[model samples]
Target: MDDAGIYTRESEYLDCYVQLGLASDRVLAVSFPEESDDEDADHALLDRIDAYLEGEREEFDDVAVALTVPTDQREVLETTREVPYGEQVSVERLTRMTPGLDASSDEDHDAVRTALAANPAPLVIPDHRVRDGPSGAPPEIEQRLRALEGL
Candidate 1:
């Protein structure tokens, strides 16, 4: 994590060839690197992630993250990040939460899906909490995250 915030993350839950950025921020390019080094990881964030996974009811709003996506997707992800632990909200509900979005429109739903699919920080944003669609994480990982939250 830089002084700005977390810009990218890789996890076992994320599939092979998952989006990886070569730059420090803004994801200048996407590629599958030959190796992953965890030596320089932010221990504090790792500890929070571990604690949350351990059913400690951790909330990540305090942690800073850098989202390099477009404005619309950024809004959707920001709203998703506010979903409280142990609670799930539908994509429709998420669309409704954002201004200028019509929840009933399929286009809006697709936008929500697209935004979630491009999520830069999955667990911290808690995309799994936005139900009825992909959470950017794999299905099994989403299930595990939900179960951790006692859903």
Candidate 2:
């Protein structure tokens, strides 16, 4: 769910960090490049994130990363369209084409939370369906009912 395009070259790492931070609240710590350094500093920062995630650090999850760059960098971002593996696809394009879960937004987060809370599933039914004409149900029927209830 990273909104940023893939990390290919060396200059786009700060945007990558911002994207990762937005995706995972667990990234409580981030250090950006000094304003004077060459742009290649971004690559180092991205490498750090890769190490953290690969190390089985608990901070990583299916979090969404949104890439944000200064307006001037728009052309550089667009260049990502030529990247292979399709990882460089813009967030807008990805959201429009993917199915199952729709693209997430600030508003949709609340909606998803509300839906999950309201519909904890596994329907409950009375036991009479499996019982004999005027008697209580047997053990096997009760077991089946309990299993369904657990679902």
TM-score, candidate 1, is: 0.75
Per-residue lDDT tens digits for candidate 2, residues 1-151, read 4323222222232222222122232222222222322333244335644453333222222322232433322222222222222022333333333233244663433332232222211011122121121112233433433343231
**Regions of model 1 farther than 4 Å from truth:** 1-42
State candidate 2's TM-score: 0.18
lDDT of each: 0.68, 0.28
Instruction: Report the number of the highest-lDDT candidate.
Output: 1
TM-score of every candidate: 0.75, 0.18
Clash totals for all candidate models: 0, 2
What is residue 149's positional error in candidate 1, in angstroms? 0.8
* Residue 58 C-alpha lDDT in model 1: 74
How far is 89's C-alpha from truth in model 1 (Å)? 0.6
